[model samples]
Target: MSTDPASTDPASTDLVSTDPASTEPAPADRARGFEAKPGAIGSPPQHYGNPLHEQRLLAEGTAVVDLSDRAVLTVTGPDRLSWIDSLTSQAVAKLQPGESAETLLLDPAGRLEYAVRLLDDGVSTWLLLEATEGAALHTWLDRMRFMLRVEVADRSAEFATIGTLGSPSLAPAAPNGIALHWRDPWSAVVTGGHQYSTAQRHPSADWTYSELLIDRAALPEAAALPAAGTLALEALRIAAWRPRRATEVDERTIPHELDWLRSAVHLSKGCYRGQETVAKVHNLGHPPRRLVLLHLDGSEGVLPVHGDIVLAGDKEVGSITSAALHYELGPIALAVVKRSVDPALDLVVTAGDPAIQIAAAQEVIVPPDAGAEANVPRLPRLGAVRR
Candidate 1:
């Protein structure tokens, strides 16, 4: 059967027991089917009761999400800024204290390894990620520390995260002190980045949510906001054309394919693990794939699951990564399609044992022609004569 239309847990995630090394404790009573999360750790319920209403609360900036299942780490010491700057896609050496920026960890091939939500509060730079990535990310950063003064520690137990739309001040500070908030930079192009999505108004241009680093002691209070779940947040994100770490990224994923450079990449940034690939794809070659929003048909009451093969007739061109029933847009999804797929072709989502396939119209996010050519010279052929 299709996921419970009434069910808010669209991801249908499973619970991941807390590891002994994890600072997190066992999940609370309200947490059950929420096991299907970005990091696989059990989180609070998809919604206290109503999902649509809860989605409203989250979108209107009146709710908060329990991000404890996600992880938080801190980078401390003097070399933090410069060291990080030398390794990521963003310019962080001059990051102002308390300001928020995002960065991506890519392989030398420019394929995304991880993306971080960052905030530097003078004392320490906080890195927030899905629970699944915490250990590996921490270990990777620690190894890269080398002789630097930076220190990496898992802060999940000491600090939890709460996500809300709009300004970081949507809620009051925790009893201990004001929580550090990392504002999302998706609304516009960052200083040294460029946008590949040609839409006059990018969907994420309306994104204003931030993840708050709060005292874990405030879990109850933070999760208290109308009891919305990841489903609610995911719907809004999908509608906004936002690309997430888990669903959108694959082993071959790069920032350009999803138009992520609008905020997460800096074209002029110093060298990092994947700088060459980033520059190469942007300047010399086009991304192998492009991102698109699929306005799925929900009349059958079936929503395509992630990994559902997308076809333009019989040939598989892509697959759906994220799908949701938005409050305003109804059922919609984000898919990574072949860069050469005809823009005018009708798309279909193929999934389920019965093989329920639904037709989808393409709302192109990244066009096939997207690439970098910073003053690329159009050299004439040696034997060609001017007419």
Candidate 2:
């Protein structure tokens, strides 16, 4: 807490490497018309051709995304499952092989430290992470391994990640004999998890997103397998109201702010680093902010970028964390706003050097008093005069 985390620690890791070689060759990025994402930690694609069409192809499950910018790590040895369950915000001890789960490691204050996608193939447990977090996470985990039977390894150099719309038809065991793909559990409330979102059905209920683990030697061929860039994946993510550590978490962020409990947190789980803060917030206090999906006015044909200020009239109420042009929904974004901001209010996202503002309509994803247990009391109207 001595140094300012907002500046020193980023919500997601972005690493710029000077190494001449990469898991996937640079020609792969150029072949797909990708422009390097500026200010991003790892070099990922901004887009390839029309992002809208690319999104459509991805939505239809015919496209693959080069996710080398993301990192993969493995934890093995006898105590792997119990060791992870003791430290994270998920109940993972009984996670069967081929099952997938998400977990978060938080600071004592409940601010997220690392968000991991967990999968165990009987022999090893894999953690999918952002490149920006790879080295730091590995170092931190290594330091915390005092007498634990778990062994950690940074597998990013050995394996690359691939994101796809639907589960690939690869056999339970890959032809190469590696059981590597992790099907996202965002499609439903994962076991031992709770949903804070009161929406009748989550927009992401149908999100069949899966991240496949492939060896570095196979990345070039995988990259050439009918590819789309990160832009396509980003658009669909926003449209589905999904939360990602790279885009949504800030220094002050808690799982409640983004309704991440749907897949990432377990309410009654055993103690962890930030259990006190989590329980206190869920039972007595409220998250300071709420997440919302915004339908942006695309008449100007300008889409706002991440970190743009969101204003309600003259006052700044929130900031857009992610924005995109969906294949069907046109321009849309996800923003986290103050809990006090009226859910019915119309907001504008201010963007660009010229300062163009896009009108936005709020779609309530997380309400003002959002919490795991739904027992909100009805307050009597204070100013109502009775006859």
Candidate 3:
């Protein structure tokens, strides 16, 4: 019943009991009716049969969303922080233990490659990301650790990620002498980051998102608690105007295009792989495209899907990246459209196989004038004499 990118199939491997303390696998594995999220990342339940209710409970901070499928990686050794700081878009060389930071790994052209949620425990730096990004990110990081006193490893098999709208009553597992909880930083602008959204009050102001890492063996118990599905999580994410790397990004995606600078990009950070383009775009040029939230018309009781064409009149301006039926918002979506599209104009989205046109009203996320924050004064025309 849900179309989230995180819902589909059944997990191939059974999350069986591995606790040395108990011989029985936690009953949660069998009782929770868990199914594989889309792309078969890991078997996570889509819902507990009532998505709307689950959304309500999660919003109330009484529910936990199982995110076991997400990939976890660890960087250890003396150079862990500085080594990774030199590779991503955040100034995390001095990230303190227990601090949370979000960063973007961009291609040489400043296009997004990976979005990493980071937490350090003094002994190790943890990288939490989408399931699909684990292998590639691990491979790349491992390759880049040439002469540095650091080491990287894919720790997905050892730990699982559990998401909560806020700190839940149950504490996260402390496997390696540290509570692996990561508080999201998207609610406000970071120290060296910039905000592109001009909203008087950003929806993320109340987004108290946090992720907890637990032993994979403990999944059964965590799943047994008050639980919600990925569907509910995706809906809330769209409403908060939060961007996800797996859904909001494309080949041409720059952090500025998604208002990601507010949390992920450090405008004054030292050189990195894509530093030149990031600097140029923020100082002199506008990103070619921007992100928007679509208040979709749900009159037909239909929700748009990823890749659905978004249009202004007859011209296709962009495509829907993520869409969902929010608990309170009816139907909503996040789309990436040309920065030139007038924010005042209502748009259309065509969904389904035969394609039914759905009217969508735009809620600006990234404005048309999002970049070139340097405030360079405009030079007058040479031929025209000054008055």
> What tens-digit string does per-residue lDDT give for candidate 2 at 1-387?
011112222211121111111233234344432222322325555555455666777888988776767777889988999989989999998888878899999999999889999998887889999777888988888888899899999877767677899655422324234477788888888766767777897888769899987655665466455677777788788878888888788899999898887888888889999988888888777889999998876655466777889999989999988877666665678899999999888888898768887788888988997763545686769998766
lDDT of 1 by residue, 168-274 (tens): 34353333343487889988889999888778877776688888766554455553345566667888888888888888888999999999998899898788999
The lDDT, on a scale of 0 to 1, for candidate 3 is 0.82
Ranking according to lDDT, highest score first: 3, 1, 2
State model 1's lDDT: 0.76
Comparing candidate 1 with candidate 2, which one achieves the higher lDDT? 1
* Residue pairs of candidate 3 with colliding backbone atoms: 7-38, 8-38
lDDT of 3 by residue, 245-298 (tens): 888898989998999999999988899989999999999999999999998766
Say which candidate scores most in TM-score.
3
**Consecutive 10-residue window with the lowest summed lDDT within model 3:** 12-21
Q: Clashes in model 1: which pairs?
A: 13-36, 282-372, 283-372
Which candidate would rank higher by lDDT, 2 or 3? 3
Model 2 — TM-score against the truth? 0.85
CA lDDT of each candidate? Answer: 0.76, 0.75, 0.82
